[model samples]
Target: IQKLAGGDICKGRIDVYPKTRENIQVALRVSRVNQLLGADFSAEQIKEIISRLGLKVEAAIKGGTLQIEIPGFRPDLTREVDVIEEIARVDGFDKVDTIFPVASVRPVRIALRQTMLRKIREVLCHTGFSETVHFSFVECEQAENYLSSFASTEDKVISLKNPLSSENDTMRTSLIPGLLKTIQNNLSKGQKPLKLFEIGSVYFIDSQGKRVQKTVLTAAVLGPYELTPWKPRGKEYDFYDLKGALDNLCSHFGLQVGFPANANRSYLLEEKSANCYVDANELGYIGQLSPDKTEIAEKVFVWELDLQKLEKSLPPRPHFQNIAKFPETYRDISILVDRQVTSQKASDLILKAGQPLLKRVELYDHFEGKKIQSDKKSLTFALSFQSKDKTLSDDEVSPLFETIVQTLKTELDASLRE
Candidate 1:
């Protein structure tokens, strides 16, 4: 082409491109070529291919790496894979074997925290709550209102050193505010019966005065309990509905948890909220959102569990218990206790008093009106008595029932209701 152009385009040898520059030298391994192409090409064949392509090919060193000097014209051939491609092109693409590359794969061990996160997501999804994701930022006022409860001091709001905007200047200390915002947004669009959840980090300063970020699982529910063909507007979701969802989650993880009294938050209705616990440590809080927090007319219930604490609270691999071959005996017991005494405390007392024979304890009824004393409340529990080896007889369960009643009366000053 230069000769036809009749210009000094190729006068003498203009070394515009460096032929032997170190930048153009690429190391190639015969094994790597075969590994990539899934073909067993010999070193001799690869070397011959490079020579034919007008590129310099050094003899293979002890490590089987051949130093191939790329030509100025073939500037693209700067890496081992590039030479492998050239070999594949010259060796006839059809001749390259079509086979799975040899590899040794091992199962990747997943972190337990990650596993729990995935499981929590699955459980929440199965429980009819749609998952939501939001930015880690919130307004300064919302952060102060919702997050002050989590920090030991009021000014622990974690502000961004360089935030994107004035609106999202601070990290969220609690997921409740975000969930409330979501509820408001959804309600504005005429979406009803909102059941939503989020699993993310909440930032705060701990008692030790260190900035901390914790993973939290939070869920919110509003509107009807259930929507059905028969009842267009089903019963509105009460505190128990939200509690039942928390119970469902606890049951799934085999976590032995309880709702202790007076788990209050500034935004939560004091009488409708309780602190959840695993052992003695506080796990989280669940309550009815105070009406003042939102413009939504219907009541909203939400629960936020410290996922970090929850991960620690998760029970060990449960040992399989054989299905009971014998029948279970049911007993009804109603107790009169002071209004201040929690049903959970009574239930725990009953479990302790009726151990070994007490298979289940369920609170079926709670009354506080004229049917009970003014200063006290009545809690009716359906107790199940069962033995793993044989059916429980009335004679065998009577002593335990009496013991439970006496224990409650002695320990909690609770009397068996007539």
Candidate 2:
């Protein structure tokens, strides 16, 4: 028991016995109902509306006024305004006047990443590569050997419990393995040297012990893939061919990309692989398919990019640079480097050699045939030199070019091609 405030009497709680209860009455006025609802209803109409409600309600008009006895069952009809609502509802809500609201800005859901993905596909297709798609599920044993973990962990793959078959027992951790399968399927159907690309998700576990996934862009070219039909000089798709397409893609998006010197990967052949990066974040890697992982009787080069990382690298706004209005000087320099050195390494060294004024460095041709030394290959690059402030002459630019060649000579033991 608790004492009452400033009183001698005390109050105590008790469990009360339950019993059946009687109905309570509520009064409603017709004029008050009309004033609140803005719905002028006749007394006869009110009676008819109540009658239509299927209740035996005793409703009538007496002495130039309307009367309605609220039903004890309708707890909502405790107020006269509620009585107005009932009449309006039974009559039809269309009777109420309609009003137009002032228009405001509406949102059209435009996914930027998805839009960019479509553009990437468009660029590749325009570059003579057809887009292809594959199942996220793959053979577990096959995927285990080609796993590329997003997070630095060994136990990163996600396997399915009720997979349709052993082939679909594991979710894909890399796109290259599935892409290789696609290539094999195409080859079996008499389609050789095909250029193909895929944009899809690769699933794995993150560092937080949760399922994580990322969208990746993977491309492959197998056999004697040719963009030009010049039959006299049938060209096979090489590392630089795929690299050229990717470079176009990066230029289209206005992104500055970097390829690392070394990418010793399981699925790629030695001396033919490099990891791509934007800023400090590793985007993905590109290389020739290792012969051991493939049974197809052709040369295959594949590239994959973690588009999730690329998406994050997008700038919120664009930056504009004035095109060099002065006449540019183009230099064709072919350097013969060791067989073990990759074009990307030589390119990096070239960029490092040509500092501020080296506007562009593009590879036009690469050869590794009989005329070239047994242990050396030739790479031809078109170096463009220009300045915003002045027209660069060969006399002024030769020193810098010589410096680049000298650096290559000292660092890579490179020599100018005869």
Which window of ten consecutive residues has the lowest lDDT sum in model 1?
A: 14-23
Candidate 1 per-residue lDDT over residues 1-418, each given as its tens digit: 5578666554476665644555477888889998888888788888899898888987646587788888767777877898899889998999987776568999999998988888888988898889998999998888887874455554478889899999899999888877888898888898888899998888976666778888888899988756567554757877877888888888878876788686757888887888888888788888888888765688998888888888888876865778889999999999999988888889989998999989788887888899778999999999999998888889999999999999998988998889
- Scored by lDDT, model 2 comes in at 0.78
- lDDT (0-100) at residue 232 of candidate 2? 31
TM-score of 2: 0.76
Clash pairs detected, candidate 1? none
* Counted clashes in each candidate structure: 0, 0
Model 1 lDDT at residue 401:
94
lDDT by residue for model 2 over 229-275, one digit each (tens)?
A: 66335667788778778888987777877786556677687678888
Provide the lDDT at 184 for model 2.
85
